[model samples]
Target: MMPPVARAQAQVLPGMGDGEMTASAERQLGDTIARQIFRDNDFLDDPVLVEYIQDIWQKLLAAARLRGELTPELDERFAWTILLGRDRDINAFALPGGYMGVNTGLIAVVGSRDEMATVLGHELSHITQRHISRILSRDARNMPLMVAAMVLGMLAAAKSNSRSGSDVGQAVMMGGQAAAMQNQLNFSRDMEREADRIGFGVMTQAGYAPQGAAAMFEKLQYASRLNDNGSYPYLRSHPLTTERIADMQGRAQLKPGADAAMPLVMDHAMIASRARVLSRPGVDVLRVWVQAAGTTEFAKGSPAQQAGMLYAAALSANELKDYGVARDMAARLRERTAGNAPAARLARLLAAEIELSAGQPARAGALLDAKARDRPEMMLSAQAAIAARNPAPMVGPLRDWVATHPRDATVWRTLGMLYTAQDEPLRAIRADAEANVAILDYVAARDRFKAAQDLMRRPGAGPVDHYEASIIDTRSREVDILVREQHAEEKKAQR
Candidate 1:
């Protein structure tokens, strides 16, 4: 027989079982919610931000897999996609079937990549442990739509933290059952504890500093002490307690000099600056960032601080149509970050982005390394090439990339533009359809796919590659089924 202490500890963890919810079902529900998100105007896919976040996210995923916490079945079945919302509320959340979200507000505030990684690792652990499934198993059961509504409501509430719990309850269509439904929406305290413990191990194993967890907790603790304004939306969902802070600090001590020194903040500073600007922090704020770059104080700051300010100023100047200032700042940024390869690369990307925005596509292409093939590079280069009417070279590379990363809606959309430039209407339509599919917009996807199919059916409709035609036909049928399934789910939810 187990000792009382051991038994109590064991009971703290949720049942390590799937219960009634299968992995596939969870993924389907996640798709439903994600489609809603994709349709939201605030959903953003800035290439620079996406690349930065994905770098940390993929590392955490690899760490989870290496530790055997992520089983092959779950890994294969889950979406594992991160969505970025442009909202300025500091929040990150895990959705069913491996979908995660990070608000730009959170990215703008974090002091280091390790701090961001800690948050992502925690969210990733929540998915790997099937926290959503376990919660549904006990409370939501077969009512996936009820849970989906509640999850969406939670997201809405998280975005606007001014909303009270009762507002969230009403938003989810739970009527006067606000208190009861709100309780159901949250993960149990035990689950939060589990996520912290597991997430700490995951982040450290992924090569992030262990101290990051402690630092993030301290930020949250500081926020909690202030008045509960809507700024710190993260606190609404992931409430901080002294015990949580103490737990992270105790774990940091166990590392014993691991990541004792602060991480080089250059890369994070640049990215966080980008996040802040991209979050649309108002014209007043943008003008301030632009003005700050030319200040004497800016000259006195450290390399990282200067790099960050330059990047933001450049981006903000571009936003404000001060292209000359934007270009000047970006060039200075590249020079400032020359010693750091990653940060330097970001500067180059920013320079290219500014040139592109300023309608100097040729200059944009020149700024990007001709030999580089990273996602952000490839994407920006593709746009530049198309703009320059030299789209041929990018076609092969973008095709290869999308073949491996089929769910990259941004790449697909860009590829469609490239195909259109090459005058391949059929291929462009197919690519457009695939882009729709990537966002889980099955209805629109089906229409585009069918349009491609119809084009292939037309006699003398340009050169028809038999293989491409076959693929389009298959995709058309697939998307048709998805559209039907989506409609059925909607009806079920309505009922």
Candidate 2:
């Protein structure tokens, strides 16, 4: 029982419901927004940190698929990507499709892996439920207004120079549309509740503690309070309420796993400590934090946590070329985590990084080799290989790593850097194209691919030849199609 305008907004379009946005048009829309997001924000592209985040996302995704919360076919189509925003705000968001972003502040603020999983699960639910598309459909009659707001947002983003705390001028069409906007807000709150209900289930079903949702919200509540009287960026978008916290707590209390005392599979303390170290840009800032952590109050936390913090401090010191502090602390970390299998591996990775940073590639390579003793680890061994030498000692390992992690834009970028240093311009151009493609930067990717194609056909005594030309030609045409489609969808959205 709604008026014409509201009814037009509520009516679902063909192929836009069931929380599934698998249509080709939706996919293109997602890519466009993701491109804008990356272009306007400072993103943390550290391989190790990104790997950890991807691991948690994969776990939640597996659980959701197992429960039939998501179909395997739809899963394959979603192109689920988790990216890190360099902003200090304790916020995370789900974009148009399956694209999700977490700020460094949110990751550093979390106390446990389960809490992180809860956030990921919640965001995943938002996508799976298709709340965003539904909102657009319900308000389809307001498309012109929405488009205008988006334009203003883009202008604002440009004016702010893509800095942290930029508002993006979204929702600028408010004065005359207050009543409609209020209804929209109410609808959004309902979506939030639904996401919470399903995301909570997603967390526990994945063999994680259900209490984590409550714990994280408790932290979020305090953070919101401290942020200019509860005006945290997440609150502005998510609108946290006392009811939501109580609901999470009530549900958590009923969790059997919490009563049974389920232990965490991941070393959350170490993970959070790593997040904290990488959150700050400089070694000096980490050194100050590490020094303060040794004080009585912080020292009382836990030995594992303390070891993690020291490991972070040591890694930072290594970046500052303080080899003495880095070597000693890294050695101590290995000793402290000797009994913990996973923790020991993390410490060793830290060791490899320290040695590599100090220009001791041999020592770094030897440490990882000793761990396997004979067999090698695809995960860490390949990473160590990349850090070993310029021109890269083991191209095999890098290729293997990229094959396994095809969606990792950072790794593709690293591969490109390696090829460039080796004076392999053609390969470097292709690698850069793949990196851009992974991030859905179609225009950039297409141009790079085209450049490589042109080089392949150039009449010169160079690396690229006829066979390479054929390969490049094929890739060029494929990417050209994508670019054409991308532009078409972009034009449609604007119109």
Could you tell me the lDDT of residue 26 within candidate 2? 50
lDDT per model vs. reference: 0.82, 0.67
Q: Cα-based RMSD of the predictions, in order? A: 6.3, 5.7
Per residue, candidate 2 scores C-alpha lDDT tens digits across 164-225 of 54343333333234445435523377788888999999988887788677778887777777
Per-prediction tally of clashes = 0, 4
Model 2 lDDT-worst window of ten: 1-10
Q: Which candidate ranks first by TM-score, i.e. highest?
A: 1
**Which regions of candidate 1 deviate over 4 angstroms?**
1-20, 141-179
> Alpha-carbon error at 429 in model 2, in Å?
2.2
Compute the lDDT of residue 303 as modeled in candidate 1.
Answer: 89
* Residue 457 in model 2: lDDT: 67
